[model samples]
Target: MGGTVVRQEILGGVAVLTLSNPPVNALGHGLRAAIDSALEAALANDSVRAVVLAAEGKVFVGGADISEFGTPPRAPLLPDVLDRLDGAGKPVVAAIYGAALGGGLELALACHARVVGPKAKLGLPEVKLGLIPGAGGTQRLPRLVGPESAFAMMLSGEPVDAKKAVAMGLADALETGDLVEAARTHALKLAEGGAPVRVRDRGERLDPATRAGFETKATEAVKKAPGQPNVAALADVVRAGFDLPFEEAVKTERTRFLALVDDPRSKALRYAFFAERETARVPGLSKETPRREIASAAVIGAGTMGGGIALCFANAGIPVTVIETEQEALDRGLARMRATYASSVKRGSLSEAAMEERLGRITGAVGLDNAAQADIVVEAAFEEMGIKETIFSALSRIAKPGAILATNTSYLDIDRIADATDRPGDVLGLHFFSPANVMRLVEVVRAARTAPDALATGNDLARRLGKLPVTVGVCFGFVGNRMLARRSAAGERLLLAGALPHEVDAAVTEFGFRMGPFAMSDLAGLDIGWRTRKATGGKAPVADALCEAGRLGQKTGKGFYLYPEGARTGSRDPEVEALIERTSAEHGITRRSFSPDEIVARLMLPMVNEGARILEEGIAARPGDIDTIWLNGYNWPAWRGGPMHWADSLGLAAVAADLDRFAEESGDETLRPAPLLARLAQEGKRFSDWGGR
Candidate 1:
């Protein structure tokens, strides 16, 4: 006989309530109602002296169903259900396995006792969604594990394992074998002994000094993230717990949580959460699409990019061979890799043994012959087409059949590169961002003739390397850099028109970017872009002047800004300002002061326009894919939900009007509103509302 989502059974007078919702068993309305009903039944049954709450899935309730957020209220809300579970007349034990996160952890906290398997993880991660724990997590967690521990866990949104959970008193015990049975026994023992223990009744007090220390740390964390409303809200909610009564603190947390749930930052963060997951679902690729096993990998070139790419493989426990053209270059690459690991170890981010193990997985050689054993070969050579073609041609001859060949090209023609190889079907782009080991994004560029399995393999490899992979069609700069070029172009014009480097950067940073374009240029070195511009015969007069004057950024202690010796931060440079003014006069540009708002509009609108073009041109499969690339790769603020979503939130009509204004002001046709953007604006539509072409 079929049963409700929550099934109750009597085992030695202990009522075992098993949450039977499929998949993640999220606590939605129906499941919440079922759980309440089961609890009521267990409470009334004379034979049931205690209760054991278990879940019939790999995870013991993966928290609230995110889809249910912002929807109409349902009876027996999560907090109420948790209260009912906590206040049950009989003792209750939570048998936690897999993950107990957010509402899941709150549910466990509500129980009299929590028994977790060794592999289980517990955390309250609502802060990541721009909301605090609404259902008493802020108040109760501090009661279990003091404010300091609770503050760090909630702020970072990272889960603690069963051992840590027990150590912190989040879980009463670690039952590695048969969690449900052990939990039932524990509950029965509790029932036989006395009345149930209540988490709410445990009033753990914190010393004034310890409370002040936690408050200071939380304040600093909030200060570090300037414009993120959730950070400040989290700090406020956590601090409130210290001063307010238990029930009063919970009420405050609930009020703050609900307010944040309706907040723009929260909405954006939630959108980004879903958008990231949506990016993985390629339109045409079926679940059955064959993905090749990548047991061994090879990376060509031993430059910075190549070394970082090699580290990605090694970190994933995949053996990698790095091929360089010369023995000297090979040694230099190995040295760079070792230095990076040593630095990480010194920072306490990595253990010496772990670093050594990762280092051991990597081997360096001087030729393509070493690539024969690799299941996947990633060419991280120079961006020149000739060099890439030569490497691909050599790889085609050397690599084993069925081996997936990938290029770590940022902005190059993948089809042309594939044409150089014999197995065009096996060729695709695995465009890892600079410092590949650190950056989470990897643009999986799908070439014209690339096979489905090749694309699948690239996606699989990216996941293994802990990278967010966004599949895109071949194009100049693909999705991210293509749109970035538009933003950079606008920033350059802003520099010449009147704004100095600091002004432009300040405007963008104030708008929620980590760094301004010019400031970032200084750190990356202006010579890099200057070289690319020179090769393409591109003109950015101020940038060219800076390069010509031997002010090539931090390396030279000057570029758009000046830096002192041994200092990373740059200061305003009058020489750069003079050069910009002179360049503006030479170009017959009338200089005018730009407000921060104007600067942001001019810089960002062009990117939105370019993104519209990218979507219309089929370069990106969906608007969300474009957003994903910007969020992960380009440092787009998560709370803004990426440029496309941000534009949608701003209203497409207003964005289109801004684009038109920018085009007219700058006399740059490239800033003209794309036809798709204009149409959507006219129709009162949005990029997020696009149903996909």
Candidate 2:
């Protein structure tokens, strides 16, 4: 009690050490030292045959103090402290009531037994920071939970609930009532010849077949990981645990973990992790900025993106008004929402009543003024600038005076739309992903004159909507789409040089994207880009011609791939290839075959170079802002970190050189290297090296 630790005596043979950190109970230096002293004191007491480890907060250990990241690490990490506890001759039972994450889970794993409350969650999420578990987690976890389970937990960094934890053998049992009393009783039973000696001696409970299956899964992961190193390294660490003795495996795990602590990917990922925390910290955005409490939200468009956005607000339990100009469109959005809810129900993730309750909160309307009193009116209208401007003008007049006027304009200038309103400061861009509700990213674009309170409200709104909000300066396309434009242009050139859409998309997807550009384009519908081009009066070339030919993508039954009914992806369309060839000849472009190496260089170099442009232009606050946008919004693979992280791994000099070669080969000046890229390349530095503040 003297130093943030509550120590108590139970019955004959049980003593308790409860960590008393506030909030999430992040295990810090003082807490660790107290835990060490408490363990030692309990070990010395003759009456204490077993100990119950618990926490006196909303959660158990939420993990290491994230605030200490990128600084000199503290002594005695959770793994070391837990090892000391395990070294004691008596049994240690960990009683977990809330989330036990990262180092928290490692500590629980070190205990001889574990009891978790029904609402408890456990996970090893070090990989999310581009790091493997440093504290014997890789070794001890595989021994207890088997290889496949451990591998997935480490790689994906997702938490498992109490039921799932018990089923997976991560938890010994569920603590039904009092966690402390249950833990103390379990400890006493173990002390009086009840449970096993320690986790180290419980190899008999592990199945050899499980190990074999895990090895196979690891092999599959390696096969999936082409150029990436971390996924394969995770698989290797899991393999070491299965092949080597326990102590030897622990040593191997430590070596791999330490080596990756300062790896380029880790540094970038850790930087991104901290930067995300700092995003909510604006100098002017203190507690003083008056925030309007928005109890309900509304979406004016009921298309794919609109329905998803509506779902996001509804999922957060905010009543949403989904307004469309047509009753038919409103009905379609309702049907899509029902299908989405039904899918969740089918996955056993939703109850029928719960789904109905969520749906019940959403009201479908067919008039622009239907949700006139909404706290926030989000217009996800057609990409046409005129349509969006019209919507904004009407929303400003129809919606309540203080209501936030948000435009879901992806690439169009947000400032121009804000000009349509009398109160420009209250208008901003809330660019969500294609299916706004499903994707986790929500880019909050700040126009030059946007009021500080409005910006704060936008950020708060995104949080309330259950999305990650990244601030980006107003520009054509904002941050995420702006970088994507560069990637798209590079890919288009690759197609002109005889690299098929499949080839380019496959190269990037194989490099770690969930889907290649063409596949995504097909899924999003090619007509989207065609419409954007027509509105902007820009030459779409291939996209315009495809749309003119009625090749509007999956809905039209033909796109880059020709689809049959019920098939999400289409087979290769030779007709599209012929179209490409015809366009190339019409433009007087000499066709040449491009290798995958050439394809990658052509596609990625421009995006990397444009990212530098974005950073210098202040469209994105930091390199990590871009990373977070792509990671959440664009489905960039987490294991590869992000584009900027990948750029750091590629080395700035090498990327600049690749851009030079691309410009020379493609004969296009947009491939000309960015000044920032050139400077960073000359200095042999990473984008992360240029830190903020």
Candidate 3:
């Protein structure tokens, strides 16, 4: 198994070609060559009547070699190897364990039959990376499992467990015992029937019933992704499998796959896929860095965010104590959490017993000292500085010496909060986004005096709790929200200059954001920002007046738009339009029509400018970190990449020019292109060109 990707063993007249690559046995060029060599040896041997394809690692074959992407195709491609298996003189069965995904599943599908281990997962999840299956997945999958099930699997891009694989006929059998032995027996049985039949030649599942509603399903698939064309491309390829000859359909799929390889959306998704891994690489920290043990945890406060934080620990199977100042508030928070869990159970997302088990991990108590028992305590109190300072001061006095102290602050200064505690090394920011249990992005803010071990613990625990940890330097709003503030400011400018909330939201949503800044603000409540603005001596004329009129948001059934009869979707209200025009007049601003493209540019480009500032200030390590944060925390479209990547794709010079023009037009110096952005534009460089400081 040393440096060998495939090991061939002739046992009981069946050649077992075992993939020996550790970790995920990705089908690199060498591995594909080794597989071909093994297959040749098996077919050449007179004693070998059948073949069992297996692997030594957890996964049989993970997928393609991502490192080989954007490069020339090597010799003996996966499709070639799969084609050899399809027309092999001897029967071949794939023994899949752990996972057989992407090209790996395509390889398995090419075999005469498949034996899946109990722990096996099978899928063709290429659509997730904004590409369809290139190696005959769209063709063979439908032939084996029928078009409807195959389309559902490919479009959803979710893996099916072993049980479901057998049920769907994707897997020939579920092997509870040794997978390779089962595969050997299955291959021998298939060989007894004569030469193996290729999956592409099978028409058993191509009945008219499978084709019913296929047109509607294909349309639905295209509708799933509005702005993105990859899904539509995938749907077209899958439809070609149903309508055209197998050979012709495969050619169609290949053409589509090759085209998608150069698609901006696919490239962005691929970049994001690598970027998430890059975020784990800390600059000053090494793999040997000590991480403080995080066993039991505590969350200070039982509000919406605080309860969500507690749920995160509970879901991770870590017992967490939720501390509240009063029993009533604690009870309310716990009840709300239970209701949320109950809804998940009702939707069949979680079992009743599992909900109870998760709930049992969360304990509610009414005191600051209750946090002292936990190894790490997160203060998810109000976003106000005084409240955070008071909690930290109390935490410093009550918490154990080695325990980590974290603040779940979105925008406040973490260093100032850490200054309240004597052990600033143990104090860091764990900025969990709203609905913390659900959001994956957790900003691990390193304070001025944060110890390496303490920072390491935050990153470690975040991963353990199934979160994307983007380590950021202490700054106002850190990376995501700091950039969000710039966008919010720009959005406000758009509203004051004649663009309505609905117009701005429409522009953003069309640009691939799930919701626009105005709609998101309304949903989050106009009062939240109004209170913050009032508290900070800041003014937002239109929003402040809306809040003053008690038009909070969807809860109040009115805000920037009308949500009549408690509707979630809002309709534009003439009163709000009048309010915006009146506000523009009051502010001595001229009203002008804004095209959707201009509205999108006005809002998004400023965030790109702020991202440049963030990178220059070392607030974020790299462009990817900002993208990962925004992608997870802010509903930034995965296809478009992040704000910085979007800017780089737009070209730095174009962005810099646009920002300069916007600044000049608006007479807003703050809207001017950042120094780093201006310099990068002048130097003909992209943000991705930076070495992340």
Candidate 4:
């Protein structure tokens, strides 16, 4: 902790204060205090003509130290230190490298000029954490860059590289060589010119015509991000700041930031931010645990999922073979992969050469034997136990000894598949969501006999493919799909209880979900779930009847909703509504109206209850694991954190009470709160408090 300090040196009348906080030089209380003292010393020395703020390590400063979050205010707050830089008598230049994000970027914005390393990334990404830039960034950045550019940076929370930064006027120049010396030279040059330009004084982009764009963006902010208030707050700050004095605007921005710090949406976003980091770590498993190297990959099927899985490997620069049983199937799969890449190329998102290179990494073959040479082979075949067993049996014989055998089963007994393999320890579940290359979540399901290294390899491979891996003990549907199943059942119950599909969907979408269950069913094809229900001898009366009537979804143009002329978004179908009413009466159930709030409660609360059960049963090690899976895979809104986190946010005791009331009202035992949840609620504790226990 003592090692994080600011080092200052006077170089030929130029003072260079280099920040030395290694591993993301976060501007903590101590570091901010040290920076303030160093700046004061540099300013007091008459010999020092200019001050160049630099860092010793690769990163300039990632952001404010999150470890100090929720703690009491300390002297020399980040705003105060940055304010000192803003009003410094001498020229101040920020020598940035790696990242200058959030408060770090705010610091740079406060400086008169910024000199960034070639690889430097700079941005005020505070809106991602559900807060506007507090340290004068909202005012200063808009003044420096145009309102449009500022909106793009702040609202999106994406960092720009040095070259882009220089273009946007975010950074003055780029330094491919000695960053500190270059910054010092830049600072000295500014000093020679007398009174370096401050961002607050720059109003070129704040003209009336340019300021009109702010209103447009302000309107777009509400529509683009509904549940998150930070976007609207940013627009309000910047639009209002356009009229006020710089200092007054900065003060207003700080007030808004502090208010947002306590907003439920902000709290949830912050929780999700930390939860993503925590999910990367495997509890009770040493970081040093040896992992099997996944140098090459192969997928057993050439269908949508298999091709997408192969693309993930190809995108990650790993050569992968996509195998199919027939030549036609293999050819079709390869074409689908090419078409997917071609779409990116057509959209200018991917260059033709890059697409060709990625496509080149993927080879299609007509046999399971083709996967024998790969280091890791994933069976993305149909979700059938017999098919999985057959593939694993073949893979056990064909694959080289110690090769990872992964099953891309959304919901199946992985242990049964592993049993067919000669080396059950090598077998595990690698459940990639639909459109596998696009989705971020991958469930690394650990079978009872799965080796630790095998589990580690699954995690390592998922990371390599740029996916979030949450290790979980094997169960039906693992974490995401299992929780989703609960929601599906609840949704069906609502349908029978007289809630229209559109009404239920409206409630969910209003609650921040991208799509409702019925709409999702239409897009995914109602037949898929209908088939699953048929296989399991389960019941989804309306969904099954829709399939039986050949209303197969968008392909057939009707299901729970109508997708006329192959439209993506579905419209309400009168027939479906009549069918739902008929089903309610057929079950001797009296129809009742369900308000949007009631529908959302019925849809979401059951999932939370099941999540509690998942945690208690040891299927998931922590609430974060389930939340991470849901947040990434199941279309759970990031702003809500996840079902479990949302429950915690709503007050666990309240959630438990609601669950009990719903259970009694619906006469559904599954809606009853899980014992673990009840216990936590009784104790007034959050899921976070459960920890590794």
Candidate 5:
């Protein structure tokens, strides 16, 4: 006899309670209620000597149903259910397979003993959601594993495999055979002995000297994630486990956990999590839409971006052919690919054998004829439309039928490039950021004539490459780069308006960006922009002058900042500051000091205004799509959500007012509030609240 989500069976006095929730066996209200009744029945039956807990799925229990978050609490909360398991008079053994995460791992910890399959992984990853474990995990984990180990695991939110779990004393043993049989045998032995030992009764494993310095040590461990209160709060909860009684410690953890769940940071992280998953979903695209298989790929160029793109395909277990115009270029590209994997091997991130396997998947060619056999050909040749057109035109003639021709253009017209080929429906853009293998964002640019299957293929390919693809319409710079153009413009203007490169960078860094626009420009080489500006007859006197003097960023040791010999970090150069002042005088513009707040407002408001314009222009599908691009691709700070989400948080009226103020002060029409922004502000609405596509 069984309930809806849990079933019970008796074998030789051992009652096996199997959670039968499909998929991941998420602990929802029904599952919790079923578990409670099952446990009660096992305890009430005098013939039942022990209870073996297991779940019927690939995962023992993934975690709590995330869909239930932020809703009203139901009866028999997770904490209450865990309390029953922890206090059960009969011995309880957990059979963990696949992943036991968050509340699932907490449930296992509440049991008397844990037997894990060889491939099982256990973790308390609540910190990733800006939460700490609420169901006595903080109290019990430290007692099972030492405070330092628990602190590291919870803070990092990474899982430990069965072997690592056993080594850390989190799991009793690992089972190589059938997990259910192993767990039943273990439970039978414990039944004959006595009541199973409870984790709450275990003493702290850390020495007195280590315990004395735990606060400082744990604080230092999480120093990299600054401004995250959950990190500090998690440390406090873990430390409480060492000093406070188990029940009191659990209450304290629950209090902190609930508080963090309500925090803005947590809310933003949760929004980001959902937004990332939503990016895979296309509104008009049907789930029944057929996708073309990308069995083999060919890359046209052999430069940095091309090599990285090749690596993405090769790492995904697809055979890739890299084509360069010359053998020397092909050799150089292959060497760089090997060197990159070699570095990963040295860093212990990739095994030597795995690197060799990926390298073996990538072959080289010297011409376009070699690409005829490829199912997909990515033109990473150059940003020039002429070069892309020539490549695609050749691919159209020589490539296999039904081959998807993709251009890796950053800021070019994909429709125009597609026009060069006969099969416009087969042509699209796969704009990857620098170091394609590492970056998670890919803009799947859909040309006006793109076929539905081709668009679906682009989305599917990104997923296979372990990338987040945001399908966008053809436009300059697409979504992320289009908004970034406005930010770059503001940063450059700030340099002429009395803010030094480092000062602008400092304000941006303080605002939670990894690097300032000027610092990024310096690292990416000022010459690339200089060359583009020269072609377009554009002028940034300070930057052009820096390039003219051969200060091509860290490559030549100087640009907006100076890099000492062999040093990656740059220092502010007084000469660069003088150059900026001279450029201001030459341009007949008055230089004025900008406060950090003013600088941030000026830079960020323009980006938000551009985002509104992009939304109005229909280049991006939704505000969340733009946010997804920036969050995953541009390092827009996940804690802030994205620029659009952040703008909504600031209130559209406030952002509109800032845009108007900047436009009036600077006389730059681009700073004027976008129509959507102005209307939304006037109507008392938010970008997030906007439901339009």
Candidate 6:
């Protein structure tokens, strides 16, 4: 009775069982056991006509305690506890708020009724963690809401609001105003004279015609989902409702759930799930480090990155001042922003009023003086040291005291930029991915002189903007694109050495990268590399010739491969092949055949090697940080567990040996295995094993 779940007496014939776990109130062993005991007591009491289940804090229950995912689950698994709850003759109502997800949603489904407030969100999000609903959710949800809606919820992992839940019949009734009071009132009504409500008995919605439609829709949905097995399994579980009895359906659900838990994809997804939470934690940093409150922010340029940065702030309801040097350039940037918002509106994501609200939050101006009032100033100007230094010097003099100065530099000297400011401690790098408003990653680069408060403030700001923040140290490239330099270079050599663009692209795409490297390159345009080459002082003759032939990328109708005019498909282009042959001959580099295995090996080994160097050099705090960067930013396949995880699977020692062989054959110093890689290989350890211990 004294354990976490407290059974407290309320009004006449109503008892309250409160789940009081901290953080997300995840139903762990203790909470699950407490729930079982409390339900037994509630059912025993003749006076306790009804019961209301609620959490003591913000959420009803977020999900399974992810900490307990890989380990043996604690007592009375959520499904079993929920089964006992479903069998309770006395009515039980779930008072829903915050995120009711995965097992949490299953528990709510087991209740006789659910009372969710307007602010509450409900979801079965196990799909994201590579799992399907195990605990009667797949069975009961389809019975209540039908298989079509259930399939969408399970496959997409999107949260539904109270209004939607009620509209779809997922909730018996939506709660109004105070959630707890409404839940109590609902329970009191059931206690007084209402008929018994059981989720399994909701057969009117699962009629023959409706069930047929659900099956048809579910068949179409699973075909579209990336992987087949889990979604198919979910559809099968839902199908059991018509073929088997309710109890039998639940047993089938549990058996399938356990099977999914054993799956490799599920393990990888679950590992990534915990890794994301772990990314927020850094060992040496004290929690006491002050985080500056960022009320308003500013972007110092009006280019693509700058405009996206401004939109990110606007999305967070933070007023942003965007500064540009010229009116035409500013108008162009604003036009890009307008087009972006228009696309969102067309997709039904942004209401016209909401778009106006976000647009109204941004103020475009021609002077840096307006930045003086901002709490945080992000410089996303052209990647040039002289220009960045000059702007920072001007900003250091004008910006409000205690304001955090951030650079949106993809790969530049954060320390040098910090040196440009008088308050070096206030300067840090916030490397937001391209199209900043859309990308989920923000590499927060820490300079040596950067203050703890500055780092904490940037990290907090990234979180507030709905982005993952991975702390990185100053280097040529921080964590992601820096290591990406090696991968990109590898991709270039692979293409030059007789492997066609499609061959290389196919290899990575088959390996689960959303796009092949060359395909991505074409989308990014061949001109960006031309600019980079000019900036670094060299001519990449092959790409230069490709650009000269009006082959920019998909936008220009061709780049590496020809695209049917205005279409996004690939075709072999003889002109590009001729250019490659000429370039190869000019360099006296003989073209040779390469296998898909070789293509993947060459492209990924550099990333693994550089990751090891990053680990040893402390540019990245941990190997997982590097993996997080790739997973969130670069579209590294989640199931493979990012690049570092993939490296672990391949064996670091094996990768090191491959690198050594590559270096010997290629005669390139960069191809030589990094010492850290060699050491780990020798020790038979993974980069993950060689973590920041």
Give the winner by TM-score: 1
Instruction: Give the worst 10-residue stretch by lDDT in candidate 6.
Output: 1-10
Q: Name the better of 5 and 6 by TM-score.
A: 5
TM-score of each: 0.97, 0.85, 0.94, 0.95, 0.92, 0.91
Candidate 6 deviant stretches above 4 angstroms: 1-11, 20-25, 44-48, 65-75, 97-99, 117-120, 158-168, 173-185, 191-195, 208-232, 239-245, 283-287, 537-541, 548-550, 585-590
lDDT of each: 0.89, 0.81, 0.89, 0.88, 0.88, 0.83
lDDT by residue (43-98, candidate 4, tens digit) is 99999999998887778899998777678999889888887888898999999978
Q: Candidates ranked by TM-score, best first?
A: 1, 4, 3, 5, 6, 2
Which parts of model 5 are misplaced by more than 4 Å?
8-11, 20-24, 56-59, 67-75, 97-99, 116-121, 145-152, 156-182, 204-221
RMSD of 1: 1.8
lDDT of 1 by residue, 1-693 (tens): 115798888998888889888898888888888888888888999988899999887899888888888899888888888888888879999999889889988988999999999889899888778778889888788778888888999999999999999998888899978888999999988888788878877765455666877888898998887767788887887788767777788888888888888999888887887788888898679789999989999999999999999999999999999999899999999999999999999999999999999999999999899999899999998878899999999999999999999999888899999999989999999999988999999999999999999898899889999999999999988999889888888888888888889998999898899999998999999988887777677888888888998988899888888898848889987777888899999889899999999999889988999999999988998888998899899898888989999899889999988888877877778777899999999999999777767
What is the lDDT, from 0 to 100, of the residue 465 in candidate 1? 96
lDDT of 6 by residue, 308-422 (tens): 9999999999999889999888888888888889899999999999999999998889988989999999999998888999999999999999999999988778899888888
Question: Residue 518: error of model 4 in Å?
Answer: 0.7
Cα lDDT, model 4, residue 463: 92
Report clash pairs, candidate 4: none
Stretch of 10 with least lDDT, candidate 2: 1-10
Number of clashes in every candidate structure? 0, 2, 0, 0, 0, 1
Which stretches in model 2 have alpha-carbon errors above 4 Å? Answer: 1-42, 45-60, 64-81, 95-99, 113-121, 134-156, 160-189, 194-196, 208-245, 248-252, 259-272, 275-278, 564-575, 657-670, 691-693
- Between candidates 4 and 6, the TM-score winner: 4
Model 2: per-residue Cα lDDT over 1-693, one tens digit each: 425555555566787888887887777777777888888888899888899999877688898776665567677666678778777778899999999998888888888889999889999888767777867788777777776778888888899999999999999899889998888888777777854466655565346767777777778877875544566678887777657787787778777776777576566567667667766765457878988778888898898889998998888898999999988989998999999999999999999999999999999999888768888888888887789888888877888878888888888888899888888988888888866767778899888888888889999888887788998988778887888878877767667667777777778776678788888888888877777666767665776778899888888888888888858977888888998888888888888887777677677768878888888888888888888888788877665567888888889999988888878866777777798889888998998897543
Candidate 5, residues 421-442: lDDT per residue as tens digits?
Answer: 9999999999998889999899
